[model samples]
Target chain A: MLALELGPVKGSAVLPTSSASGENAFRALFAAHYPFIWRQMRRLGVPESAVDDATQEVFIVAARRMSDIQPGAERSFLFGVARRVAADARRTRHARASAVSEPLGADTADEREDPEQALQGRRSQAMLHRVLDAMADDTREAFVLFELEELSRREIAELLGIPEGTAASRLRRAREEFMEIAGRMKATASRGAP
Target chain B: MKRLKDELPEESFEASLLAADAGGEPPEGPRRRALDAALRVVALGGGSALVAGKAAAAATAGAAATGGGGAAGATGAALAGWKILAVVAIVGGAAVGGAVAVTRTTDVAPSESATSSPSAPVPLARPEPAPPDTQSAAPPPMLAAPAPAPIHVDTPKVAVPSVPSTVPSSAPVFDLAGEVRAIDRARAALAGRDTGETLAALDDYDRRYPAGSLAREAAVLRVEALALRGDHAEAARRAQELLAASPEGPYRARLRKVIDGAAASSP
Candidate 1:
């Protein structure tokens, strides 16, 4: 019977000097961080349809820098990649937007087990994205890292390379803006409710 | 964590962030695409580690901020066809190669050689159907997807009753150099801007070694050649077909690139 056969590829330049172990580490990192990175990219404003590419982009960076990702900091490295990829995407969308005659596939819109719950979920996510998009870039980064990601303020500061106090202040501003938007959304919903 | 009150049960911050996407599970295509892309990067010997993560963070952010209006097509432009092809090729090769090595070790060292045919050297991680409950222990997000089906061919199972094994002795190891030579010749034709020559070279390569290792690279070249010949209609249609077939395949990105470039440059 005809079967596809495969075997060890040697002398290939892609094989890093410390490949076996490095590859294992890379695979582990990919598994653990993929979903989180996917979500983070979406939250950071990569279109949902493009999240897979963005996630791959992050890991693509990671694979190249396997040795450089300090053991405990894979998340940080990945989040950072998501951040850059998202920013780049945003610029692209703004640039050739006129040229983009059609909206992208966006996130998959599969019917969920619970239709109402899914509707609510979509609304919340839409609002959340709106709120985040409205916030200043630095403030959004701080808020996302500190609150959504549950990283400590100190960690946010370290991650964003801002001072502890600067991170703290951005968090404060982000929260205020978030609540302001939330209040407005609630008011709109209530007005429509009666 | 409470960014907004009354947000837990009905409007879970996490669920909104981490719900099962509308797509259900991650589509099977991109993993292969991603793997292919990664391999291409490795193949290019381009300082494999992603542009020094630390440096990339700083440099990319600054570049984006300044790139402004012109930064629109930066992504497709940044990763040229060859670089992407190289990365995906490496990852694809690695997956196939890893499976072979693993199977070889298992076959030679073990006693029950009857499980898989001696002649039918198994592909990487042949997947046995895992027990249903076995995967229950994993977290919800963990189930987004498993490794590419090809990579998981690790488990020896009934090799599909097929036509027969026609692989040559050296077929086990992919002839990457030869693959590279083929790609280089096509690329040369492409560079020389001889659309007919480029198309001919790509077609000849595909016909000669239908299952040769660099099949995707050949596809990328074909799509690119079609575009160069201003056969944008056929190019786009072919690319879309290939994309639907392998959405996450490494060649998809370059295929998309050629399609996008044609669109952008056209009236």
Candidate 2:
């Protein structure tokens, strides 16, 4: 069997030895935080399809700089890597968009429904989706990390490489924008009613 | 609004997150290709370096011997010894390297065969007719003088039948080395206590062989590997996934043990 023989290094516990052992320890740490790192990438707006490759790239960086990462801060380190990867992807997308002609929105058509309750549910979901879509990127990220992912503000700040206050402010802005969009959606629905 | 949130379901979000993170079953092609490429490069570089180093030393010794004619014979013998040492080193290194490469290639094991034989046919007995009433059948001819005592023989020449070679073998004929390698990698991940590598390796195995018999054991090991790496929640979730998928799987007991262990160890 062609196994990745880890010559002599042992467990996931961090050793006080040279950087080589530290790298192994960090590789171990990176494995533990993989899900979170990937989640951060997705929540930060990297498409689901691209998240794995981006996540792999993130870990490659992590692996390369494994020795430099501080103990107990591995989570932050991974989140930071995820944030950068997400930004890079967004930038690439933006560059492509600039180069190519604008394309029609390709959102899938809503499934056919006739019942009033089902219609109302669809309307609600649509309203929420629109509200989420309209928010600024940073605000959306903060809100998702905080409300959806249930990460603490401190963690969010660390992940975004911003101050804790900024994270809180972003969340507040995101919530307000969501409320406004929802209000508009509700007004439009009422106006359309018999 | 409350109903809408309830209908959306927290579990759905969790599922989406997991799906998003899982990306898909890993790309086996790329990983294997990359590993192969790396090994090739290493082998080539090592080979070149060995050759170059030997050539350089040989040239230096040759020059030294040429500059000292008085000690030429002794130098020539020493040079021959150096050449032998160099050849030994290069040959030994290459052999070891080849062995390592072969050991690294994960492949399948061989299978076994089957067949068996038949027995003799039995003679059926015919029904005897009732004694004729008309003429007493000439009194049965007095048994015809006992039929010459029926020349008895000692042993019957029974035909020992050979087994037919047409049946298919039921033995599994896949790469045991690959499975063992995968298990070893998982074990290494577990030893590192890295939840990520362990989960990734498990996921890789599962993706590559969804219906593999050893999948359940790998899943159980994944849970342990994750837990050892200090990711209790993910370990618990994975355990739940395993239990839900195959409650009666071979590794169910081990899965439960890992789950219990994780729970106990969780903060």
Candidate 3:
């Protein structure tokens, strides 16, 4: 006879046979993917504050659709939900930057390795932020989800409801635009350097 | 774009790329709390769907009983049952589809303080500590006491009648299933660090069933709620009471962590 492993199972151990069990499974799945869903929402152009609303909306859909989701496709399903939630948030003009850009005071800079490098880092970040701000919504989203989010073209296509080839092309166009903007900012900074 | 990507050292870009892939860290401060609250809403929707489905099923069964035809009625009833199932499936399916569509088009930016005001106040409660000895064979201290059962503060009086004595003449009545669900909801809310909904649910439970057997558990949860709301003084007092009431409570360690975390984060 085969021996069963004594350790606790990770992921969904109970089948969603009943509506209640299905709901529980859905909650477990959402909790497990909370960070991923949040990140995807951010990259898609959701603002930091509204990310919660978007995330909640995504899970609400997941709960309702628990029966339709394939047993093994929970992660992909969530990403799908996240993509839709992010899109809805975008429509409402609720997309915002994450909180990392909050201006830290000079006193908080005590741990820097070198002041010059730190200052340069801030400048570069500012320039990058500006460039990101200027990109069209689709191009920006494609680039962020592809490059920053590291999602494959196929995944991006599914999430955005576009063809894989379209996702790749959009990513390329976005990268080109981002580079052109960044180049101008860098040259301008070099010329003005003391 | 190439130059910009190159301008930053590969390491920093790589770090950011990794963080982005990991969805970055949880939003800090109020944003994090808000996100947590949103997640609880999602979890609640899941529970709600189940309830709705059950209601739909019951309605369909009642409809079947009223109209009995020959063999045709049996076939019609079967078809109706299938139709009900289909409707449930479609509603749930559409919800998931909607969520995906929303996530795709949204542009995530940090909201201006003005726009984000409504979402910030929602996640104020912390999670309640789990009962001690949940994992081990040892029963919880409350279970051993054999004392008078506490009244459920939240339940309707008609649904759950009051017991004449602390030790009821009948068997000990415990809604283990509902308690389990409440516990799960509480934990989910806590994990998101959403204090508002967490506290609301706890308070709702208290009102619905005034003398709940889990009153001590709810009291322990109150401390976490106070802590999350930045009421450290109140949190400490409640934590002390919890410890005093159940010195060997399983959740002592976790409660201490909550206290420490609250202290560290205090301005």
Least accurate stretch of 10 residues (summed lDDT) in model 3 chain B? B95-104
C-alpha lDDT of all candidate models, in order: 0.45, 0.39, 0.41
lDDT at position A77, candidate 2: 52
- After TM-score superposition, the amount by which residue B113's alpha carbon in candidate 1 deviates from its true location, in angstroms, is 52
Query: lDDT tens string, model 1, B1-267?
Result: 344233435454333432322323454455544544443323232223222332233234323422231221233133222111122222222211121110001212111111111112111011123321221121001000011222332213312112111223322222223343355456556555566887787787776656654455567567767776778878777888777766654344456665676677679
lDDT tens digits, residue span B1-267, model 3: 232233456545322322323346654442333333333322323232222443333234323322221122233233321211111111111101111000111122211211221222211111114433232222121110000101111123312212211222221122222332354344335434567876776776666445543455556556666666677777777787666655555445435645666566667
TM-score of chain B of 1: 0.38
Worst 10 residues of 2 chain B by lDDT: B111-120
| Every model's DockQ | 0.05, 0.01, 0.06
Here, model 1's chain A TM-score works out at 0.70
Instruction: Write candidate 2's Cα lDDT for B1-267 as tens digits.
Output: 111223334434222221222222344432232222212211211111112333333334323422332222332333321211101001111101111110011121100000000000100000113211121211100000001111110012211112111111211112222332354355445544455886787787766555442344465566666655666788778888876765643334445655676677767
Q: In order, what are the TM-scores of chain A for the candidates?
A: 0.70, 0.65, 0.59
The parts of candidate 2 lying over 4 Å away from their true place are A1-23, A97-134, A161-163, A181-194, B1-267
Docking class of 1: incorrect
Where does candidate 2 clash, by residue pair?
Answer: A31-B196, B107-B175, B108-B174, B108-B175
Tell me how far the alpha carbon of residue A19 in candidate 2 is from the true structure, in angstroms, after superposition.
8.1
Order of all candidates by TM-score, from best down to worst? 1, 3, 2
Top DockQ prediction, candidate number: 3
Candidate 1 segments exceeding 4 Å error: A1-18, A67-72, A94-119, A186-194, B1-36, B43-267
